[model samples]
Target: MWIDKLKDVSFDGRMMHNMSLASLSYLNIGGVAKVVCYPLHVEDLSNILNFCFCFNVPVLVLGNASNTLLSDAGWSGVVISLKHFLTKITVENDSIEILGDIRLEKLLAIASKNNIAGFEFLTAIPGVVMASINGNAGAEKCSISDLLMEYKYMDIQGCSHSVSKKDILCSYRKGPLQTFGIIYSACLKGEMSQKDLIQKSVKEKWEYRRNRQPISERSLGCVFKNATDYCAGQLIEHAGLKKKSVGDVAVSDIHANFFVNNGRGKSIDFLNLIEEVRYCVQNKFGVFLELEIKKVGD
Candidate 1:
């Protein structure tokens, strides 16, 4: 359908259909995408968007897929990846403008090198800048949205728009970015600090994360968002689901909130585990858990 039209766009990266998603996601699950297009520049992305708009075709803007769960049945439309468009970091007196495709880890390293203190907490996060912004991704101390000053994006109709931090309602892993466009770049406001101090802080946070999380494994960071006055990990642990397994997907022994994919794990197995954990938590306590990870395409 839309595949024929996609050939018109001058893409610098790979473009393919029926591509396996397991290689893309952190959890290493999911089937395939009908069409996966990685455009090299913003213009390429804009052209594709315009084509999609004219034909009423659906588009899925994917980042690094760290927090995404794709169904085994696969995505049926255009899946645009911004990975190839990453470029340039301009550091001003008090702000940093970064391209959207840059990974958060790389951004954090850049900030640390520049003595930018605010982004230190994000070093341990495992996704791209756009994905972090899309979810307002964060931990206990900070979120990506909190440091953002403004962002440039192409709307679904292929029109460019700049949104300021104030224009968005950002809170607890949720952002005001509508699911109908592609983020190009963003400017972040951060405080400058001494190099040694920033480095020490980053190291400390990294150490804490390493000690507490099974971050090196194949897992989708956190499964559920923390409810008010309670941690989802704590709840899952209390529900007696730690080390629980459904096929090859298992609740991480180190962290109950994380669902790990052992060898040959299926997307359905991970989904089943989510439902089982939710049921157990709801039955044991009166609270229903909310998913932090995004699930798409069946």
Candidate 2:
């Protein structure tokens, strides 16, 4: 069996069997995961990946779980979390080399300390560096891809590769690595500025998101990507679906695109609300909103 073969692999990091996905997801909603592994280093991850590949077991790689929704039916494959692994950051003269697991908050503090100006927009993101780069996490002006110089990723075969930013295909809320491979590290360039100026920018970015988003609530960030012609939040709000509810989940009145878990919300409730809002928005505007968040599991 695959389970038996997994025991023979050389893995040194943490492992949880039959773990609850709710504990890992930012939405705090989901059923159990068959197995979750946290690799200590690149080789450890490669080993796990190699094992999975050889056994033909499906695999899912996740960072902070901020931009993903884990289904209630649960994933039958191995879930690899880089949140506790590959978290290293080094600052050069005007650039930064960061690992996958580093959180945006920590990166922001470090960048500000180093007088880096361009990273202030990251204050609006609540995820780790790799996932942010994978999703091209961004604010009004720019995305994470704007700061990237080059990135390293491991393929499904456990082989590592690097690609320069000039070779990367990046767009709003999307990046090249989203479907290709697992990113482990990246080099990003930023402008040198006064520390106080950087701090001010960070604070302003934080304040903007704090006032606009339901920061204190449990959610999978924005539910729908903006349509070609209109903002998803504005459309949902115009449809009068703000504060719309399904079981314990409700669309945030503060930001109609975000559906918050009031308490004890299930993934099903979130999914139901998503459908209802999508139907309402489409019926009113004739636009079918695409999901911004990644949905995992059956």
Candidate 3:
């Protein structure tokens, strides 16, 4: 019935029935999802949200699925992805207004072209702008919140609100938009810098990540959040979890905190590996590692 009714809704985007979540995720490890919808713009997205809310159908909004671990059991309700559309960037003096669905790579490109500096640290970061902002994603003691001046979001009831950065609470790996239903757009401010310098910074950051992280592998980014005063990767390596495996998934040898899928890896195996790593790190370092990757379904 839900599927039938979903078809009746006026949607201005693509939809797939019984879509495989693995195809959408960076880890490439998840079961089928009942429905996956890619809404083009805010109006299309709002319509889908309202329909799901009215029918009491569960909803999950995914960006790039870079840091998400979807279950093998699959999602029962609608899964909304904004990666296909809603990508618009406007440069206004020293500020940039970005739509939620813009990919980090695209954002960085545009920023560089416009001589916007300060986001060089996000050179090779996966996922879209919304997901990055949601997790306050960054490295080298920098974060997306650094440039964020304001953001706009729509609640579950499809009502939109704009919020200033000064009024929001943002930390190392968390942002104030968690409770909000969906972030539609954001304004980020950056310093006006020389194009050559920005490009050089971006290249250096990208190379640094490429050498240290298992960027080419199928992974869900960092598996654990760093403990206070300790890096998560160092902790995991110190715990002797490097190359630890369950099924086809294993802790990346390059980065101990990253779990990479070799091939046909199951979500259950990934979960098991997490437990194993957590136990090892806890026992060895007396720190119970906290998960940084978001788990969904099952």
Candidate 4:
């Protein structure tokens, strides 16, 4: 068994058996993860990857679970969550070096305390700093990639590479992680500015998100990628998918693009809702709607 193989490896980290993935995901829905490993540090991450890759153990690299959907049948392989121990953050005058798992909320506080500007736009974003960079998460006409200085990540083979901004090819809601595995750390630049200005910007951004999105609901972020000049929310709304439900999962009435788990939501319901929404949108507009969230498991 794969569990027996993991036991043979010398790992200075943590592991759980048949863990409920719903607890980790924002949607509060998912099935069991057969074997879940949490690395202690970067070296521990490499060790875990090496063991999994060498032993032919199926590896599912997960971070904050903000953009992931796990099937109800459960994951048959090892689920590796890198967030539990990747916790290092350094704030310098010119840059801030942060681990991939550090939350954006904490980074916002760090920027505020250090009088760092240009990070206020990130105050309202969900998940860790790397999540934003991985998906090129954006708002207010700016993206996390715009503020990046450089970043370091690990490939599936556990090899580390430091990439500069020029090397990183980021598009709207897309990032270099398409080819990469796990991000280790990033150095983001911030400028000195008036403290009150920073506070105002953060407040405004927070308010914008609160008003526009279903911030209080259980969702896996945006359901689909934007089409051309129109956002996914607009397309969904135009297709009359708002408030549409399948089982316990329903599209948010406040935002058409956000599919929220009302109560006891299941992955099957989520997938069904996606199909319904996609079918409607495509049939009406003749444009295929692509999913933004990553689906994992059986």
Candidate 5:
């Protein structure tokens, strides 16, 4: 279905059909995408979107897939990945402009190189720039939304638009982003700081994440969003759900909020684990756990 609609578009990036969905996701569990298209440039993306719009082909905009879970039944539409267009970073006095596909880790490194101080807390997040923005990704005291000044994105009609911080609305891990649109690039406000302070803060945060989370393992960063006045990890641990497993997917022993892939894990396993934990936490503490990760495709 998607292929027929995209036949007229000239795609320069990688293209795959019925590709293994697991390889593209952090959870490492999914079936396959009906069509996966990676556009090499903005023009290519525009062309594809135009074609899809004309033919009524469903499109899913994806970044590094770090904060998503794909269904085992796979996706029936077009999955457009922005990985190829991530390039260039421009640092002005008080802001940094970055391409949408850049990884958060790499972006933090760039910030550190430019002596920017606000992005240090994102050093350990494992996803692309757009994913961070789409989910308003963050931890502790800072969110990616806090640094965003303005962003350019293409709507479902293949028309580009710019949005300022005031035009956007976000809550926890959800934002006002449309699934059919693609984020092009964004500018983030950051304070210029001494290299020593930036390095120190980055190192401390990185070290804390390394010690607290199972960073080396295959895992979706966090499973559930913390409810007000309570931590998801703490509540799960207290409910005796730490180290719980469904198939090869297990709750991280180090962080109960993370679900790790031991080996050959499936999306069903992850879903089952989440449901189990949610039920347990609700029954024990009367608290409903909200998912921080986005589940895509079916």
Candidate 6:
């Protein structure tokens, strides 16, 4: 009956049932999503939301899944993915318009080829613009808010609105309209940097991120947020938590704050690893580490 409600709505993308969450996230963990819908356009997303709202079905927005963890028990709701619906990137004047589904890596490549500046720092991150915007992801001391000028998002009622930079309240890794709804697209101001200069900056930053992180491992990047001037990785490493492990999950040897899934790592193991590291860091340094990654599902 729930699936019947969506049957009448016209869709421009794929719809499936019982899709594995493990195959979707970067860590290759998690259980199944009840219903997964990949919408092809803004209208399609609005339709999906409207239908879900009418039927009182819960809606979950997902993207690249680089910075999130789904529960092993799985989600009992409709999971909407903008990956196919909003993946376009366009240039207007000195600003770039990125659809919510656009991957940051693809955006970097597009910007680099066009000799655009101001996004070199984003190369260090690994998620789509939508998820990054949700958490206001950043690197090299620069955040997604730094380049954001205007953005568009649809509310729970399936109504879309465009927002300006000043209207957004940003702090650390938060966007003003973060929890309002699903973001559609964003327009960011860019500067004109030399092609060679952009290339060099990107290369340098990319290399630095690769060197300092466990980039090759199956992990969700940084596991915790910095509590103060000291990085979370440094705090965990200082607390001697690098040797700690829970089943196949372990604090990354490369970056102490990164928890890696060493082949078939379960969500329970990851949770235990977090508990151990959190307790150790707090006891040793008298500082509480905040989680940076989002954990979803029931």
- Top candidate on lDDT is 3
Scored by CA lDDT, what does every candidate get? 0.84, 0.86, 0.87, 0.82, 0.84, 0.84
Badly placed stretches (over 4 Å) of model 1 are 10-13
What's each prediction's TM-score?
0.95, 0.96, 0.96, 0.94, 0.95, 0.95
TM-score of 1: 0.95
Residues 1-298 of candidate 1: C-alpha lDDT, one tens digit per residue:
6667777766666788789877677777878888887877777777778888888887887887888897888777878888777588898866889875788888888887888888887867899887788888988657888898999889888788888877877878876576676778889888989889988988998899888898888887999988668999999999899999999999999989999888888889999999999999999987899999999876
Looking at model 4, the pairs that clash are none
RMSD of each: 1.5, 1.3, 1.3, 1.7, 1.5, 1.5
lDDT of 4 by residue, 179-249 (tens): 74777789989899878888888998888889988888888888898756778888889988899999999
User: What value does the lDDT take at residue 189 in candidate 1?
Assistant: 81
Specify the poorest-scoring 10-residue window by lDDT in model 5.
Answer: 1-10
lDDT of 2 by residue, 1-298 (tens): 8976777889889888999988888888888888999998998888998888888889988878898888999889899988678577889988999875788888888888888888887786789888888888887767889898999998887889899977989887887775557889899899899998898877887788999999888887888987567899999999999888999999999999999999999888888999999899889899999999988886
Tens digit per residue, CA lDDT, model 3, 18-77: 999998898888888899989888888888888988898888878788989999999999
Q: Against the true structure, candidate 5 has what lDDT?
A: 0.84
Flag regions of model 5 displaced more than 4 Å.
176-179
Model 6 weakest 10-residue run by lDDT: 171-180
Per-residue accuracy of model 5 over 6-113 as CA lDDT, tens digit each: 565777777788887887887677888888888888777888888778878778777777888888998887788887774778889868997657888888888888
Stretches off by above 4 angstroms in model 6 are none
Model 3 vs. true fold: TM = 0.96
Q: Which is the winner by lDDT between candidate 1 and candidate 3?
A: 3
State in Å the error of residue 194, model 3: 0.6
